[model samples]
Structure formats: structure tokens, C-alpha cells
Target: MKRGKKYVEAAKAIDRGTLYDVAEAVSLVKKTAVAKFDETIEAHIRTGCDGRHADQQIRGAVVLPHGTGKKVRILVFAKDAKADEAKAAGADYVGGEELIPKIQNENWFEFDVVVATPDMMGVVGRLGRVLGPKGLMPNPKAGTVTMDVTKAIQDIKAGKIEYRLDKTNIIHVPVGKASFTEEQLTDNFQTLIDAINKARPSAVKGQFLKSVTLTSTMGPGVKINPIKVM
Candidate 1:
């Protein structure tokens, strides 16, 4: 595939062999984002742990100091008072039995995040086939499956993000929009890196963070020296 002019220029700006300092990487990534629209800046981290082992899996969430710069639509699965609570907490959509059919028969899916009270898991479970693949399922580990619907809704609305390993043992997360300042991006990046380091599984015998890279939506990646970032 032919690379776009902007991408080619951005690629040329990077030193492919050098692992830049985290702060320097963040700055370079921002400078290389030549998209007309405000592109999102993301961090892609490769870990030493093996994804094939359940005990070695590293998964968690964090509330970035600066929000993701995207609006989040939340669908809450609750009943009666719980449903009302979700709405009170700014959930975009709240429902019970009606939602099941809406999502099942009508193929309803106009939301970004989904939160559910523990009691409603049985109903939410029915949509697993649909929601699971999209990473929209409300899992307890991500704090989306809980009785505290209000807190859960508020937390997610306040820039909370979940990170989990893929089949390659890599975790990709949005740090912030490219429009954010270097300080804001650095804070968010460090916050995420700290969270990942803190969640290190005992099974990871080697360096927990094998590699870290920062990039914008359409820019070439800037590799970060893991030692400097840690």
C-alpha cells in the first residue's frame, strides 16, 4: 500500500533505531501528528508476561488525569431504583427487560460504554455473544459489573479506561488527544505506566514492561526506552 504524504513525512521524522526517552517520545509523537482533525494519542505497551497463561494476564483500569477527549455514552442495565440511580449519575441510557429485546431483536447498540448492576448480569449475559467481541461487556474486573451503578457510571464518565492484554501480550490504550499539551500527555502516560507497573503479575520473572511506544492516530510510532519510562 502506498503511504500517504503526511504519513511518509511523519515516518521520516522518526529515528527507527533509537528508543527515545518517554518525555521525548511524547513530544515527538505530538509533533508528528499531522492530521487535520484532532487525532488521538495512544500508548502501545508490550509486556514480558505470556498471554497464554491465565495467572500471567494483566488487566486493569485507570482514570486519566486529563480525560480521553471523547464523549462516552453509557448504557446501564438495572431495575427500578438502580435504573434511576444510573440515570441520576449521567448514564445516557438506562433500561431493564425492554433493553434486552431492543439489543437482541432490534440490534440496538448506540453506546460506547456499558455498566450493569450485579443483579442484572443474568440479563446482560444474554448479550455476551454480541457485546463480548466488541469489548463492551461489563466485566467485574473493569468495575463495570457492580451494585454501585452511580459510582460506576460517574467513574467511567470521569475518564476511566480499562486496559487488557491481547493475544500478543500487548496492551494498547489512548493516553489523550494529540491536541493536549505535553505536560498533560506526560501525566497521563506516566499514570498509565505506573498502573501497569503496579499491576505486575508475580509470574512475570523478567522486566514487566518489555517495550513502550507512543503514537498518534495517523503518525509513525515513537519507541520509548522502558528504563527511562519506568
Candidate 2:
């Protein structure tokens, strides 16, 4: 893949061999962010655990302190009062069984996040094969499947993000936008790091966080001292 001019310039400014502190890494990310639009900044963490094991899987959600600078398009699978509650709580779309056919046939997937009431899980379960790979399926562990439709939508709108390990044992999570201040990004970084640290399973014994990289959508990644990130 050929590097874009702007990206090349940005890469030149970073010392690829250096492992910067979280604060300094964040600053470099912002400085190198040359996207015309407000691009999201994310942290990609490589963990020591084996993602192939169920107990070793790193998966959970957290509400960023500064919030991810993006509006989430929410879809709730609920019925009656719960549906009403979801709509009132700022859900962009709410539905029940009718949603099944829509998703099945029309490919009605214009939403970013999907939340479902516990009772609706069976209904939501039918769409698992469709939604799971997309990372849109609501899971209880991620707080996306719950009885409290209102709080679920509210928290999501407030920047609640789910971080799950990929097949490579790496977790990629957006911390904030490049336009956010270093302090705000740092706070989000701290929250995410703490959450990952807490989610660490006791089964394994190596360096929990093998590596951490922070970067904007179009910027070069800045390696952070993984030990210090905690």
C-alpha cells in the first residue's frame, strides 16, 4: 500500500523507535492528525492472553470520561413499554418482531449500536449470525442486552464503547477524536486502560499488555510504554 503524502509527513515527525508516555503520545497523535474532518483517535492494545480461549477472551464495555466525539445511531429491539422507553431515551430506531424481517430481507442496518431488552434476546438471537460478525449483537457482558432500555440508550449516546479482543489478541478501541484536548484523550485513555486491566483473566501469567499504540484515523501510530499505560 502506498502511503499518502500527508501520512508520510506525519510519520516522519514521529520517532518510530521511541515508546512515548501516554500524554506525549496523545500530543503527537493530535499534532499529526491532518484529516480534513474530525477523525477519531484510537488505541490498539496487544494483550498477552490467548483470544482462542473463552476465559482468556478480553471483552467488555466502558463509558469514556470525555465521550467519543461522535453521535451513535441506536437501534433497540423491544416491545410495548420498553420500546416506548427506548424512543424516549433518544434511541434513533426502536422495534420488535417486525424488525426481524426488515433485517432479514431489506438488510435494514443503518444503525451503529444495537440494544435489546433481556426478554427480546430470543428474538435478537435469531439475528446472531447476521449481527455477531459485525460486532453489533447485544451481549449482556457488554451491557447492550438489558432490561433498562433507557439507561442503555443514554449510556451509549454518552460514549459507552465495547472493547473486544480480535483473533490476533489485539483490542482496538476509539478513545476520542483528534480535535479533543490532550487531557480529555488522556482521561479516556486512562479509563480504557483501567477497564482492560480489570478485565484481565487470572488464568495466564505473562505481561498482560504487550503493546499499546495510539493514533488518529490518518495519523501514524505512536507507540506508548505499555507498562506506564497502567
Runs in model 1 deviating more than 4 A are: none
Clash number for model 1? 0
lDDT of 2: 0.93
- Residue lDDT tens for model 1, 1-230: 88899999989989999999977898899999999999999999999989899889988889999989889899999999998888899999999777887888898899999998989999999999999888899988889999998888878888999999988999999999999999999999999999999888988897888999999998999999988766
Go through the candidates in order and give the clash count of each. 0, 0
lDDT tens readout by residue for model 2, 1-230? 89999999999989999999988999999999998999999999999999878889878999998899998899999999999899899999999888898898999899999999989999999999899999999999999999998888889989899999998999999999988999999999999999999999998587999999998998899999998965
- Evaluated with lDDT, which candidate comes out highest? 2
State model 1's lDDT: 0.91
Model 1 TM-score, 2 decimals: 0.96
